[model samples]
Target: MTPRLALADMAATVSSEDLSNLQLLLKAPSKDAVRDVCLQSHRAPSRRLAEATAATLGVPVSQAAELVRSLHVLSHHVLFYNLSSPEQILALFPESFHSSLKNLITKILLENSPTWRTEAVSDQISLPQLKDLDWRVDMVTGSDSVSRMSVPTCLVQLQMEDPCPTAGGESVSTVTVELSRESLDTILDGLGRIRDQLSVVAGK
Candidate 1:
């Protein structure tokens, strides 16, 4: 199965903690909680929510800075929504977080597409980690780029980049990623942990 399909399967089996954390992170009003969510979300991007959380909790700007740093560390492995097509990825996240989802989709498309040498000289190639989502784009000359884009729950845009370029004076041939329900579940589980952590911060 494709990674996205696997993720969908895993998302189906989310635990109470995952659901609770997700809700709390999205709705809570604590700066620390917001920061925790941001960090856990894998730097997935929730600008509006982050700002609101910071304001509600009266968190100092310096503390917010530190929180952002912590979030970076947490997000390293988090599956950003932008790693696939926006329409497909948004379907996976809760509808309430559509804004965040859109941002995630954009991020993946713009930032995550891979770059590599193409068959044509002076040509480059890139592919986003769209996983199981069906997508088609007209091939272009010079640089052939494909991306797996997504919209994250945090209303952030994200895209994974994987490029396959031809030898010389050619175009990128193909690019793909394996997907499975189990793997997607694991990724969601990790994201849930971040949600839980954010809830804790919000409690304070």
Candidate 2:
């Protein structure tokens, strides 16, 4: 499936050390062990899960915990990238990882993808969102021909809603920000870079 997340550029963010830890971790846990650890990650506290994982994998608690963390980081990155199938995961991770490690990573990500997607949706719905955006252009014109010149500016008003607001607080907030031509051009340039990055990631 195509990726749903805007991809906070996870491919660049995940480190070589993280992948190495995950590779080592794959050799330690059986498929069933990995399934249980993934389930426990959603339910248990960090320390408890680490201890349980340590005992299950017969590794030191710190090492086990680190492995679990690495697994999670990689899993989320996989999910965010929407690399659902083994082929897609391999495509993204090939050369760096061997076949077996890639297979296991794919399996773990598949097992956890559904729940992660649900949680991501719920998280997004709970946050503030922009309801409407209104904007206008204004010009400053000098009075006489001797001083006749025009400067233009844009004013933007945003209507935002907090789906879950603090007690006794307003659910909707109005904010206005001003953007000069230069600042607007800078913002547009930044947006262009982001668009190009997405296109590259999507193989467009």
Give me the candidate number with maximum TM-score.
Answer: 2
- Where is the poorest 10-residue window by lDDT in model 2? 5-14
Clashes of each: 56, 0
The sequence of per-residue lDDT tens digits that candidate 2 reaches over residues 1-204 is: 454754343343456776676554554557777677765653323887788788887878887777767666666677666666777766656486877756766776777787777766555546689999999997756546543357677888999999878889999999998788899899889999999999999995
Model 2: lDDT of residue 194: 100
lDDT of 2 at 174: 96
For each candidate, give its TM-score against the true structure: 0.22, 0.52
lDDT of 1: 0.40
Mark the regions of model 2 whose C-alpha exceeds 4 Å error after superposition. Answer: 1-12, 24-29, 42-45, 92-98, 125-162, 167-204
Query: Any idea what lDDT model 2 has?
Result: 0.70
Over 4 Å off in model 1, which ranges?
Answer: 1-20, 27-36, 40-82, 96-204
lDDT of 1 by residue, 83-109 (tens): 344455344356554475335433443
Q: Candidate 1: TM-score?
A: 0.22
lDDT scores for all predictions? 0.40, 0.70
